[model samples]
Target: MNWLNKLERKFGRFAIHNLTMYLIGGYVIGYGIYYLMPNLLNWLTLEPGMILHGQVWRIVSWVLIPPSGNILTIIIMMMLYYSLGNALERTWGAFRYNVYIFSGILFTVIGAFILYFITGGFIGLGIFFSTYYINMSIFLAFAASYPDMELLLYFILPIKIKWMALVYAVMILYTMVRGNIAVRVAIVASLLNFVIFFFSSRNMKPYSPKERARKTKFKQQSRPHMTYPGGARHRCAVCGRTELDDPTLEFRFCSKCNGNYEYCQDHLFTHQHVK
Candidate 1:
């Protein structure tokens, strides 16, 4: 099956697959207004004390809370999150993508729990819900792959992902230094997620049997199609297939001729001159 179909089959339209984004978005919009309006979020009747008391719901509610009260800023953040988040979901697959996001959430919760237990219910719980770093990690992941990809700034000039990520990183660093303890902790937790996922990404899914077979077939079919740098490791100069990625793949000089070739395993004897 095609890659698109494979992705859809694995992650499309499941409630568990995407509920966190919606839940976080909705709660943040609600409670952020509550903090500003004072009388809002009455339904939740959120209490700082209850959070410290180990309320299970806080762990989930914390994800939905937005740090800012400005409508325009929230809109911008949401737009960036949705656009970049969807792109990442497609690239990482549903399970791995979900794990990356929820793992950050878990870290934030753990940080808050530790603080709460230590201080004996004295600190604020609202700060634990900070998602800026979570969002930043997602954006950074995108920047990692498409560093040069550009987006319109205010629908005007184009800006590269790497530059945008750098600006955000600096802002977060500044905030960690200037903001309250909760903000600093949130930043640290989020950053921890980003670093752990990037340098030590054991989360990527292994190739499935079918995919392995398909890749093997593709490798073999393209093996005789090129010449390479060395007789043993030579690859199709045209296709760029080589044993560099995998050493177990068997390669032949030519499928038709019995004569041995001097090309690399990637393109032992397969070549055709263009007219």
Candidate 2:
């Protein structure tokens, strides 16, 4: 994590902002190619055999492979992934988000080559590696960050993010269990980023309804108990404002102060510490 922090500090400025838009655009272009020149897709696929035979472009071109054949499915998939991807960018900043996505792609590429070497050129029947699971990694990060967030499943039934994540986890588990060696390798390779980031990053801690309630209770209990002469709950030492002034105003006691001195939200960080 310290290394990641240092890397972020060093290269954060170069991080591409709004990277999800470009990814969706790539999908659109890929769909266009799929429709117009369907035969070209063969050359663009991530085939290690093809690459070994002098087709170097497959390394990058394979990223543009459309995840689905149906137009509606592609549209919905793009929208869903865009939403999750942008949210992750906002939460982690552009650099970390880019690292996560690119790491998945890198791992998938490595997995493809490894498969090629293992199987002696017959990697799989179809495009072995794709961005499908890279997009899935975005959802995993979203669920980890906002486990309590809910969505209307199919625009009717309400479901929490964590529940949906659980469903995806089960599906992946089933695929790994029943799938062939190629399929299993592909799934694990694509999801390696999520596995690495989730384990390495402390922010990906598991959250549940019980954990949420416990955190809320602890926060409420941890608040300082101070009483003014007029039965007032909180009074800012600087501006002398009380709960009677504005019911919504937050007050926090300054730790640096010699005695009990509180400040409202506006001055909590800006106010000088009492010596």
Candidate 3:
């Protein structure tokens, strides 16, 4: 995860903003491709065999393959995930959200390759890899972050998000138990980001969005008081520990955070990014 901190510092400027919209846009194009030139989509799947044979475009183009569904279902799915993705981006900030999304895509690609090699390229299963589970992860993350939030089932019945998440967990568990190897790999790879980022996120279990806003404001107001523990110039934003607390701790400022946020060596890579 520290790799993310280093990466943010080095390439955070290039991170996509409102990344969810772009993914939705990709899905729109995919739907167009699906309806207009269905055969071409086969060429765009994440086929490691074809990739090894020099059709490297499959690595990126696979994302354009929208999840299989009727038009109405697809539209509703897109709308729901777009809202969830934006919520995550707002809370995690664009850089971390970009990392989360891109990481899921990356992991899926890697899983495809691993499967290909394990099966010795006999499967020729390009169609197996898609962004379906990646999109599902957005829902899981939103549920974790806003457990108490309610959504309308069928746009009629009100239900809490956490219950929906629990349902999802049961479904995923069932799939893992009953599905074949490809399903298992896809599920694990795609949802790995949820497992990692959800747990590591900001220690935010107790606070609501409004409470977080208040706390953020309080943090900004308390900036001057940050230099503590024998007036050390650098104090970790996460632990509030300074040079005086531990002489061995090296400190650095996060270029990705909105302000002059410094972190000690232990937390420099792991802290929740401040926007």
Candidate 4:
């Protein structure tokens, strides 16, 4: 996480925010393929009717497989994932984004483990990643922000991203109904994180009052200070008031005049200012 600080200083908020989400997601997928796949495959394969002997790694590897793969498909998916994920990170900030992602992963992992114990082994759990529900949290965030944003389907017909998201959700339900019980449970498990993290989080203030004040102060400090059109002034020309007198007050450009001015209570109406 030290690199997170470096990234924050170097590339600013959006860069580290985005990199954080992608790193978490990419690590889960990469680790699954590198370590879990071999261990799980000894028990089962892609073909139907394959048997799994409750390999522990299978519980985790199931999250890594993408629903589909092709250069075009992957490009489209990656673009959508990045766009939604970054949008969420920007809207919710770094801590919330991390919570959303890790919470979903944790919920799915836990549900899988429970199912493993109940069934005495990993079985019929292919539906977790088979549908896009695992990634729905990102899409849900995007839909909340730009529900009316239009997207082309099959690159031919136009449709709103929100409506498409709704349709995708329905498709998930349909697939779950038509799929195995384990698959259905896994899909629910994947989405349960959304309910637990975001729904309940509506009432959960992640920041303390002190932290809120600190963030507000930091934002004000980081923002570019306003100045006059001509030259910087230490005191208000109209009222003879110095900036040091009221440090919190900000001076801005005057809409009615050519130069900058700050008005104390005595000459407050004498100038028009823009923040």
Each model's lDDT: 0.63, 0.83, 0.86, 0.59
Please count the clashing residue pairs in each candidate, in the order shown.
7, 0, 0, 0
Off by over 4 Å in 3: 1-3, 200-211, 219-275
Show model 1 residue runs off by greater than 4 Å: 1-15, 18-49, 52-54, 67-69, 118-120, 202-275
lDDT of 3 by residue, 1-275 (tens): 56667888999899899999999999899989999999999889899888988999999999999887788998899899989999888876788889889989999999998888888885567767788889888898888778899999999999999999999999999999998898898899889888888676555532446666787998888767665657787788889888887889899989999987889989999998998
lDDT of 1: 0.63
The lDDT ranking, best first, is: 3, 2, 1, 4
Q: Which lDDT tens digits does candidate 4 get at residues 103-173?
A: 67677666655666677665554444322565776676566556788878898999998898788779878
The TM-score that candidate 4 achieves is: 0.56
lDDT of 1 by residue, 99-162 (tens): 6777787887677666565567764455445666777788887787567889988889999978
Displacement of the residue 143 alpha carbon in candidate 2, Å? 0.8
lDDT of 4 at 108: 67
Clashing pairs in 2: none
RMSD of each: 10.9, 9.1, 9.5, 9.8
**lDDT tens readout by residue for model 2, 1-275:** 66778999999999999999988898888889988999988888888887887989988888888888577767777888888888878777789889999989999989999888888778443466888888888898889778888988877999999999999999999999998888988999999998888786665332333455677776777454566767788888778888888899999888888777789988888888888
* Candidate that scores best on TM-score: 3
